[model samples]
Target: MPDSLLVVDDEPAIRHAIVRAFAELTVIEADTAEAGLAAVRERYPDLVLVDNRLPDGEGIELIARIRAIDPDLPVVLLTGHGSTDLAVDALKHGAVDYIEKPFKIERLRTTVSHLLDKQKLGRQVARLSGKASGRSHLVAQAPAMKRVLGLIRRVAAVPSTTVLIQGESGSGKELVAKAIHERSARAEQPFIAINCAALSEHLLEAELFGYEKGAFTGADSKGKAGLFEAANGGTMFLDEVGEMPLHLQTKLLRVLQERRFRRVGGLTDIEVDVRVVAATNRDLRAEVVAGRFRQDLYFRLRVVPVPVPPLRERPEDILAIADHLLKRLAPELGRPGLAFSDAARQAMVAYAWPGNVRELANAVERAVIGAEGDAIRPDDLVLDEILLEQRPAPAQVSAAVQAPIAASSAPASAPALPPGTLLIPPGERHLARIEAMVIKAALADAGGQKSKAADLLGINRTTLYNKLKDIGLEQAESAAG
Candidate 1:
């Protein structure tokens, strides 16, 4: 299908010229801002060309409305010689580009083509990143995971099918969703996700369907667009779908059936073209039998049910996944080039990961921070010691941050502060000064190794670098300097 363009201008001659110039596209024209907005609602165009001065309102004002409707829809401001200021203002309001009136038609055509091409390239890059990141996060060398991968590849080819992913917590259902979306034909579009169990029914309804301005107290005056509108031409991942409110489920079912829905406080029914990918830990069939889930919605979502195996079910993957996590966590935690000892490896494989991959990731992160040496010992695993050794209490962290200079166990050579002087204060300027001091102190304490300093501060090296820049402290600065 050819891409559609909307030209909103008061001048009939200008509109005629624009329509004639873009004969290759399906051109839609409107004479006023009101009519332009109506045309936008009627035909969702890929690009819009609005005159800076419209009969109903300035084109700049319409850009915000256009953005509220579809943030990514490209808009170009059409201006005359003296309207350059208005054109610039329109760009600030979300117009992608501006074209001067009495301009060369070829230049305008080239500009439009270039902007569209750039937008397409951006979407393509986002799609590729989604694919690469999803694949990397999915660590599946075992047969069970390989089977899961195969299923994802197969279903991804069918973009319109609603995929229901069943898995325990931390089994990476979101990763599977991304894989399917990235591989699908609609990869270049958005991938919007929501957790049904995370919000109250009222809030969930508002979030999913949006609301009109001043629909309720504290609502943004400009209103908002919902995930359905945001995810148009892409995929929507509804995590914990079984936990969705019954009334909202009915509304969701309507959208799935008719491909349209009305916002919470709006009368207009908005159309959307999006793929649905739902996931839940609960058995939807059982929920339906118990009368806790809607059968129609359940059946609609389960058209291609994909199950993700828990980490314990694939014991062969225990060591491999641990090693993979360590390779990532070790450097970030400042324990660069650290390795798991033979005993640690053995202990990892022996233990059943009840909390699944998430538990494993936390275990590795903790071990990276608390380990006494370069090699992670069996004792460092701490899986069996949760009951024996209490986790670090809140007081310990508080004391570390707030201890008085005289009370601190720092070396005698360490600079002393005034009695009862708070190292960090609530004020932004004071907090910044104290933060800089702390970074300087950590770098000094770590002998100026950025990674080691980051580890000492319980932050990643990248974060440390950003802080250093913020404090005007060069990375090369040492304790002596």
Candidate 2:
């Protein structure tokens, strides 16, 4: 969609001029301060051009009010009575730029375009860093995760279904919700999300279902559209839904059941086609039993229930997720070509990640910064010592397992050792030392062919190369070849 620009000036000529200049944008006009504020709420413009003086109030004050609604919305002040003090005050009041009367249209266009581009860039950065929307691909290799993906595909086929996602914190509930939306028929529409516990009761009401003009104290005089209206024909993800107030829960239930809602303090009901995806770390069944949550709402939201397995339960995915995280974090942190030591990989697999994927991401970021060499060691991971100590010891290998280790020392021309063979010396519990010995044996068995050695070790060539570098066998491999 083309960006929208709001022109708030009493003079018809000035507004018309700007609209003509920016013919590409959807220009909205407001003749007075009151009308301008209302247009801001309803139209959701990308940029604003307000005359210094309005019929009802000063443009300087309106800038502050517009900022209260959206701190990031770019506002440019146009003044016929140009003064240095007026320009400084306008900026202090939150106007991004102040232009004197009879300004060049090209200059105005340039400023507006720059601000919009900057905002777009900022949003893109936030999305890539996983701070804004959950639109990225999910890394799910474990069988439990595959089951969750299966559920998502089934639910996505029914775009209007209300979904309730239950999972521990940081288990990627929002990501799953986004996946459903992206795969659904309404993928082209907006996918908006809000944390139910972040706002107060009244604010949350106004935010979800927009209020009409003069609805309540401190309310936008020109009533605003709520997230439900903005997210029409798409998905609305309500995070921490279990913490929503009871009164709001009743209203939400109505919206879910009827697909219609009246703005807070508004008489007219607005119908929407938004799919609501509600998620919570808390068990809503318990909350319903305790009378803290509405049973009817709980039933309404759970039309499709998706349970995301925690990181600890999906042990098979730990290393895969870590590698995924590293691929993103490596160059970002200026630590490219980094690899985890065998000990660090073992420790990460053994550690029960209480905080789940979010915690693991943080640990990887920290390790990237803390690692002194190309290899990330156990200390670089900085896992909980107490938890590591409490973990079970490695199981003893049988004679059959020992046979492969013994055969791995054979000459290059000898029969290839069985796939997935690793030589762990008797009574050897040191993970790094055992890993080194296994890599050496694999190299010996393959006659220093890294590719064949990687196949025998059941890993990719890049991973085998990293292992070789970590174990200081790179020089030996070069010499043997």
> Candidate 2 local accuracy as lDDT?
0.82
Error of 1 at 273 (Å): 1.3
Q: Cα RMSD to native, each candidate? A: 26.1, 22.3
Which candidate gets the maximum lDDT versus the true structure?
Answer: 2
- In model 2, the worst 10-residue window by lDDT is 402-411
- Model 1 has a clash total of 0
Error of 2 at 236 (Å): 0.3
Q: What is the lDDT for 462 in model 2?
A: 99
For candidate 1, the per-residue lDDT at 4 reads 76
Model 1: lDDT to the true structure: 0.77
* Whole-model lDDT per candidate: 0.77, 0.82
- Runs of candidate 1 with Cα error greater than 4 angstroms are 1-136, 385-481
